[model samples]
Structures are given as C-alpha cells and as structure tokens.
Target: MENKKEKKQSKGRRKIEINKISKKSSLNVTFSKRRQGLFNKAGEFCVLSGAEMAIITISPGGKTFTFGHPSADAILNRHLTGNSTSGESSTNLVKGFWWDEQSIESLDLEELNQYVESMEVLRKLVALKVDEMEKGSDQSPSDFLAMDSNSLLDAFASSEAENIE
Candidate 1:
C-alpha cells in the first residue's frame, strides 16, 4: 500500500457537566443565550399552532424576563376570564387564588355569599400588587397588604383601563 498522511479530525461539541458554572461572565452569557432560545421556541409554537403563549422567567439574579405572542397581560387576562365551568375541574389553581371543588350546584346562599366575599378579597390583593408594580412604586408586599380594599380596587380599575387603552 502507498503511504498516505492522515488528517486529524476536528473537534465538535462535547458533553458538558451539569454543575454550576464557576465563571460569572460565562454564566451570564449562557443565561442570555438560553433565554433567547426559550423565547424563540415559544414564538415558534405560537406561530405553528396559532395558539397564544406567554413565558415568565426570573433570572438567577432575580431580574424578570417575559415573552408573549400578543402580550403577557393580555394572555393572563384571557386565561383568567375564560370560562372554567366546561364540566371539567382544573387541576391547577390560579397563581394568586385558590378554590376547592365543592360543587357550586350544592352550595347554599350563605356559602355562596362567603365564597364571593373571599374571591373579592383575593381580587383586591392581586389588584393592589399589580397597581403598585404599574406605578413603579417601591412599596413592599407588606405595604400592599396594609392598603384598604376599596382604594386598591380603584387603583386596579384605573390600571386596567390604561392597559386596555
């Protein structure tokens, strides 16, 4: 056989350990790239399925990142307001509210009233938190908890109107 020089194979991607990255700069770069990839996949799903989608992720440094087909708020409001009484109980509870599966058909008037009142309280608390965030106020969660329900509802309504416009 004729002697021939063999060329070395180029190195490709290698398996990396799943340990925490030691380098801060590398970690940040990786986070940014991965976050972009996640958003791209969500957008692709939305486009291919004609379905609305939203993603909310908090970075390791506590900064929030969000991506939505139309908007995060719009998607959230749609999900919240969508009819949930289609003969199926949701296994997952809403982010800020909890309800059990005591059939509404079985509840008496007093129980129904109590349920409605509890829901109103939860709604006010959520609205207050949303209002503070919209106003860019530096108030803590405790401060929001201390606010009156009526004022919170008013703030929340104004914010809702602004969002609609």
Candidate 2:
C-alpha cells in the first residue's frame, strides 16, 4: 500500500499536469506532510550550523508558508537599512578596523558603518575615563598624589589652574 502511494506521488510529480490533481482526497495531506518535512530540515540546519535562513513556499493553490532566523523580514531590513548593534557586531568590522588600519581591502559599507559606530563608542568611553581621573584628583588631591606624588601633584595643580582660569 505504501509503495503504491509512493509510486503515485512520483507519477504525479513527474507529470505535473493541471488536469490530474493527485486525487484531492490524499493530495492535500501529502502536500502538508512534505511541507512540514522541509520546514523541519531547515530548522535542523539552522540549529546545528548557526546559519540564518529564510524560506518562503507557495502551495499549489497559492497559499504561502514562510519560515526562518528569528524573523526573516527583520534581518533583511537591518541589512538593507544599515543598522548595527554593539552586541551583534559583525566580525568583519572588528577585523577590518582594529586589526589593520592600513589594509586596502574593501569592506561592505554596512560593516564599515558599524565599525565606525563602535569606534565612536570606544572614543567616548576613553574620554569619559580621562574626565573621571581628573575629577578624582579634584575630589582628593592627597589620594591622587599617593600613587606618584610629584607627577600627580604637578598634574593636579595644572588641572586646577586650568579650571580656575
């Protein structure tokens, strides 16, 4: 019985005739089962390989089934709009900018944009740290001088003079 069904399915797929719909009684069921199998295979690949995939299928009657990577449209929109998050920073960005600033190799514009944004964030953090150090000296000169008296005192004094002026 199973072999007979398989044979019929093979025949139907090969002939692909508009006139011969695979006995409406079983055709819908077969289509549904096959579609599920395809979806399951896609899910397995995504889980094992960490791949982002989007699948869109249209049934013979024109119904559509779409699946993939958290949300297919969201990923596609991000790629098109050039939005970069710090958490999901692209590897290319890190390699291109920080690894070798002199390299002539071209990077994707979106990835380069992300790199520039990250660099700006780092620059802001460093500036903040410098400001905090200056404020620490202002808050406690003796404490600031404990580490290196002469140099700290000189810097603190200069910093204070600059503030006053």
Candidate 3:
C-alpha cells in the first residue's frame, strides 16, 4: 500500500496534459494554482509595459482576481471600444502619455445636460402619474414625490434600516 501511494504521489508531481479531471478535488486545486499564475503574469506585463489593463477571473474555488489599469475602468473601456472622441479616452492607446483635454467647462456642460434630460424625463413621468391619479388609479402623488425627494444622504439611512430589519 505504501509503495502504491508513493508511485501515485510521483505521478501527481509530473506535469499532466490539461483536461477535465474525474477527481473533483484535484481539478479544483489545479484550477486555483493556474488562475493565480495567470494574474501574476498579468501584473508583470503591466509593470514592464507600463500599460493599462484589467483581467477579471473567478477561480475554481470561487475566489476572484482582478487586475486594473492605472486609471482602471475608464482607460480599459476606451481600449475595448477602439475609438475615442476625447483626450482622456485616447490616453489608453498611447502608453506613458497622460493628458486629459476634457476641461472643467465641458464636464460642467455634460452634467447640466444630463440633469436637464433627467428632469425632463421625470416631468413626463410625473405628468403620466398625475393623469393616472386623476383617473382614480392605485398609484399616489406621494409615491412620485418620494421618488423625486429621495437623495444619497437619505438612501444611506434607508439602507441602514433595511439591514437592521
């Protein structure tokens, strides 16, 4: 029995062809080691090339590994798209060159436009709700009012109450 066990241990140490294993436990262990090795390689590549990248993977044991670019998601998204309209987006394509031409004025304009669009949509929704209310519908004006009034600060307290429950 000891001789057989020693032979099996020696075989296990030898590199085996990658395939689905019948033994569930062994397969899981192999997957975890390979996944860690892959992440380490990615980190090395990032360090050497000075490039932005994101590699996300879940190990066989259900552990997650994530590698991010210096700017992280913002730069990764631009590379995936293959085209960029702004300087911020273009920086990902050219390594080590970091300059964002997206000015505060443009950012402010975008924010204002988004706010206006959101407000317009909300107004339309409220008008529809008001029409529904007028027709003796189940939905109340208070519901619409609450949705508009809810803010981030209020959301935090509401979430705390939910967790307590």
Clashing pairs in 1: none
Q: What is the C-alpha RMSD of each candidate to the true structure, in Å?
A: 13.9, 22.5, 16.2
Best by lDDT: 1
The lDDT-based order of candidates, best leading, equals 1, 3, 2
Model 3: per-residue lDDT, tens digit, 131-155? Answer: 9899998544433433433553365
If scored against the real structure, what TM-score would every candidate get? 0.42, 0.35, 0.38
| Highest-scoring model, TM-score | 1
Local accuracy of candidate 1 as per-residue lDDT tens digits, 4-102: 878888777888779998888898778877987998999999789866677887766666677776556566666788943422222232332335556
Q: List the candidates ranked by TM-score, beginning with the highest.
A: 1, 3, 2
- Quantify how close model 2 is to the true structure by its C-alpha RMSD in Å: 22.5
lDDT of candidate model 1 versus the reference: 0.67
Better of 1 and 3 by TM-score: 1
Clash counts per candidate, in order, are: 0, 0, 0
Q: Model 2: residues >4 Å from true position, as ranges?
A: 1-21, 78-165
lDDT of 2 by residue, 1-165 (tens): 555544433334354435545677577667667777987998899789877667776766566666666445555656678875423434433555445764435878877765665556546554755787777644232222223336644755565466458
34: Cα error in model 2, Å: 1.0
